[model samples]
Target: MPTDHPAPSPRPRGWLSRFDTLRVKLFLAIAGANVVLVMTAYLIYSWSFDKGLVEYLNKADENRLQPMIVRLAEGYRQNGNWAWITEDRQRWQDLSREVLGTGRMPRRPGELAPTPPAQTPSDAQPHNPSPQAPPAGAPPSGPPAPNVPPTFTIDPRLLLLDPQRNLLAGPEGRTEQAVLKAIVVNEQVVGYLGYVPRLQMVASLERVFLAQQTRTFAAIALGMLAAVLLNAALIARWLSRRLRVLGDGTAAVAQGDYSVRLPTRGHDELAQLAEAFNHMATSLQAAQQARQQWIADIAHELRTPLATLRAEIEALQDGIRQPDTANLDSLAQEVSRLTRLVEDLRLLSLSDLGALDYRFAPLDLGRFVGHHLNDAASLSGTPLHVRTELEQGVEVRADGDRLDQVLNNLLQNTLRYSASPATLQVEVRRHDTEAQLTWEDTAPGVPPAALPRLTERLYRVDESRASASGGSGLGLAIAHAIIEGHGGRMQASASPLGGLRWDIWLPLNPEPANA
Candidate 1:
């Protein structure tokens, strides 16, 4: 019977994926900037308009009334004739008429308009009929009122002054007009004028100004939007190029190629990111190579014993050989080989995980060297020859067992690889706060290329020889880890014996060294 299961849910999108569209982000940013810019611009425009409008109206008022008053005063001062005087009155009447017209004409196209004065003749005649009349209506008005002056033909509907401010000597009538006052000179009220301009005219101009402002704001907004989109595209393109490189590198690494490198050309954050990525790639490549080499070394090490065991068992099954001591020993050797491999793997794991514990103690260099020298001589089945170039009683402090393991590994390694009856040398010296131990063997030296990789795990110069000599391929690795764990430095160099030279460094203070 089949079991029921719920349908699999789709993966949810992250915030960066859902809301990070480049174009949309750019648009929103541009929009926010424009809002602030336009608000500030609008306030400036409104203030300017208010200030300019008031100044404009003041100039208009001065031009209209001040020039007329000046002319009347001058004419009266020059000549007392009513004709000269009346002529000035006619001009003032014309000014009032023009102001009441549909629009204020700007000085008749080419004329440089004049200004008004503060004082004028008070004896000027009235623009309307006399109120007293001549004795019981007296022949229906004196001299026909002189045909009422052509300047007065303008419509009264647009008159600037209301009835209360009116100075005209005429019959009473009701009409609505702007508030105005006439200047008094020599006891005569003449020349009406408005201080605050007509609201209708001001409102009309304001509407047009507002429309211009809107157009200007829109144009600026459009320009900013275009600039934002262009910048976003350029940035996104650059980022995408780097991302593509990273993706390709990832794919190459996945396919077991660790030699790929990323470009580091720019000084931007992306370049730093690329640098970090390249470093990671390089490290991974090294790790992968080491792992592969480890597997191959293990296989090669185990294959011989396995093949021998298989051959011996097969021979016995076919009755070609008896179950004798020789066959049992062969099987036991195979088991021992497998056990050694497992132990090396375990030790490496502990070292890598920083779980290897040590018991530290004071150690004497002279005594330690003598003991190990004798031990290596016996194990290699060759005469131990020691050439010492050192000062005695150089004492250092560290874990004795771990340090001995490091020395033993190097000693055994030299003996196994070096020719038999080789001479061994041990030297001890002190420099500043640190002590050094050097060991060399009189055997054929390693090649220049192999020297640098000698400390690498499972790396060997002669793999076939390593198997015949029963080496587990982890001796140098263990030595490296032990010395490093003790806060010391271990390095290999060319020896005067024409073989490998190993050096171990330990601080006399026994404190951990800075990496």
Candidate 2:
């Protein structure tokens, strides 16, 4: 034989997988986009700076280099060796030393551009004299024309080399990677202008601007990352906590506890869900209580009649009671009580399942209640005072058989539950679009709270008395069901006769029953 076992449930996933969740993913997406935007903006700013700096540096270098190139060639031509340039060492020292006075550097033409400088520093002395500059006793240079861009300086570290690569004049060493400009006299190449650029050209003070911009961008990226992570954590924690609570509540309810309640704060969809859960819990609890009550009441109702029937049969078998009509009638009555209980239960089950059958038609309500009261007044075979205040021409659409049964149940209740010498009043009248009927009887009425719950199945104001009277506690409940099935309303209220009142309201144009 194979033994069956339930399948094991899957284990919960680990928290690290939370990174794959929508909240974390969305936050990271936004953060990544912000970082990309910041980087793009920084790149654009850097490009613009380089472009402007190159243009400015190009103009300045042109101003400084044009006259110097011609002078270098003239010196080489006259001395035939570089004696005119090398003999003047003090000017060479001034040229290199003034590089420090202003925080700017020279650039190789057609290569990396030099950084732009502010106006020429005041402490600056002339290095390479322009052709326009006055020689000894010569006329001083005239002021530049208006609307012209100011002049510039060039300070490229240079070497001169002949065709055989012989060092002629410049710093006395070979430059590893210097661009060469050919020096020409009589349109013939003689020596080369070997130019080496200065080291780390941008000024030290200007480095601060670049550094600050870099720091600002880095800070923004880090701050945005931190914010995204924090927001993701908060959102994930909130969703998981609420879901866990809901899971726990459901587990408790599954174990037959319906009293669990969840917090319903905030004006969000989650709060609405909490409210609906609470409502479901309350309904479940009420249903459980009703089921327990129905079981106990049914058991009690069956036991009394069964016990009576058994005792009677035992007495007849023992010959203690003769087989006469009176003793037989008692047994039949007990059997009748048991049968009534079973029938009532069957009808209730049918009504509860919405399977009860009905045949609907228009009826004169005033005449129906009048005839019902007269029949009730004569049923007891005892003379009793009955009052009537029935309005004529009161009509309604309903299931006539069901309505009759409801009225009969109410009349039986008055006879069984009320004190003797009670006066019963029947009335019918129109109230809005409905026809209202009332049965008010004399003393020993139901309590105020009991009246409201009287129509609940198996609910009885006096359980002991109801049980002794062979009531299964379903009379009023069945009557209420009948009335409701006919698309009408019924209620128990305080009567003017110092007794219970049964009020019925039936819509004049009630919907027909389903076929």
Candidate 3:
């Protein structure tokens, strides 16, 4: 014999398996939105901050270069030409360093030391030609004191250009995209000082500052993202918990447990759903109770006649009672009562299922009521006093046969339940858009509480008396159903005539336009 073995369960695929639940889906949706927003803000802030910082640096550089332009202009005025410093490259380098207050440039290996300029008349007293005595409180000024070292250094890229655009001094190959300042002397353009604009921050302090700010921004972005994800997770968890409760409740109902109810705490859609679910459960519970009661009532109703028939047959078989005419008549009556009860139940079943046939036609409401009352009184041979208050020409759309059945059931109930020599009153009239009919009888009244339930199937006020009088208890129920099928409603109330009252309302038939 082969050995039996269990197969292994399939494994879940990767990390995505954890995201299959509603909680994960909700969390991901919220977290994804937060991430996109945070990232976009970070990128935008970085771009704007970088551009603004560059513009700020460029403006500061322009302001600092203003004094340098003015000093160059003064030097040009004193020399009256550019040859004094241009011919001696060493002199030009010294002037540049002294004017801008920058550190001295380092010399390359094997490079000759720069020679001092020769004694030329133009070079004797450059940049200062004002030969006046110093005023009191004014510091002695021969050459202007060098400005404190600038925050930034640009000595290597700074250059002097003559009026014709020829490079006079400073580094070569850096004139492209250079910022230029005009050297104006005596309202005439003399030369230009230019420096290449910085493409990125090169100063150690500036680089450190930018890097620190960038790190701060990134940290803030990350902190915000983390907080948003936490909040998203909390919200998703809360929602999923509520949904799980709903799912459990629904499953309980499916399993025929109609008592499950969910908490309706908030005014959200979920709360509304819970309320609706509770309502459905309550209705199903009532329907289930009603179904049980209906089965019990049917069994009880059938057993009475069945037990009587069985006892009578057993008596005749044992010869304890002869099958004489009187005995046979009693059995026949029991059978008739049983047949009537079964037929009534069948009719009620058909009506409940909306399977009752109806042929609607316009009938005079007052005339119809009068005709039924006369037939019932004459045929029943009851000594009850009958009265009719009929409003002529009150027409309603109804099925004639069903309308007759409703009237006969009401008359029969009156005859069976009311005391002999009691008054039976019938009234028909038009009230607004409806045709209203009221049928009331005198004495042996039903209890107020039982009045509302009179039209319920197999309901009887005096069960023993109703049974003795051969009442099937389905007459009113069937009558109510037929009236409803004919687009009418029947209501039972405490009769002013001291018995039960039945009120029927039907829509009035519309008059023909040509009429």
CA lDDT of every candidate: 0.65, 0.70, 0.82
Q: What is candidate 2's CA lDDT for residue 483? A: 87
lDDT of 3 by residue, 1-515 (tens): 99989989776688967878899999999999989999999999988887788788778778777877876777677557776567757556655665555633444458654433344775355566667543211123344345455456666668889887788887887776777888888888888899877677656566677899899999999999999999999999999999999999999999999988889988999999999999999999988887898898889889999999999999999999999999999999899989988988988889989998888888898998888777777788879898889999998888899889888888888888889888999899899999999999999898888988899887788777866777878899999999888778899898888998889999998874234
Question: Which candidate achieves the best TM-score against the true structure?
Answer: 3
- Across 1-515, the per-residue lDDT of candidate 1 in tens digits comes to 99999999765478756656544565456556655675677668766765776566545555655544454344444443223323234333444433333222223446432322232568454667657432210112222133232332222322223225553321234323333445444666544433444333444445566568658766875676666566656665666677778788889878978889988887888788889888988999888877887788778777877898889889999999999998888889888888877787787889999999988777776677777777766676666577877666677777888888887888778778877677888888887877898989877888888987787777788876876778887889888888888888888889998888988888775543331
- Candidate 2 TM-score over all chains jointly: 0.63
Off by over 4 Å in 2: 1-218, 263-268, 510-515
Winner on TM-score between 1 and 2 is: 2
lDDT of 3: 0.82
Clashing pairs in 2: none
What is residue 234's positional error in candidate 1, in angstroms? 4.4
Select the stronger candidate by TM-score from 1 and 3: 3
Runs in model 1 lying further than 4 Å from the true structure: 1-218, 237-265, 312-334, 364-367, 390-397, 510-515
> Alpha-carbon error at 348 in model 1, in Å?
1.1
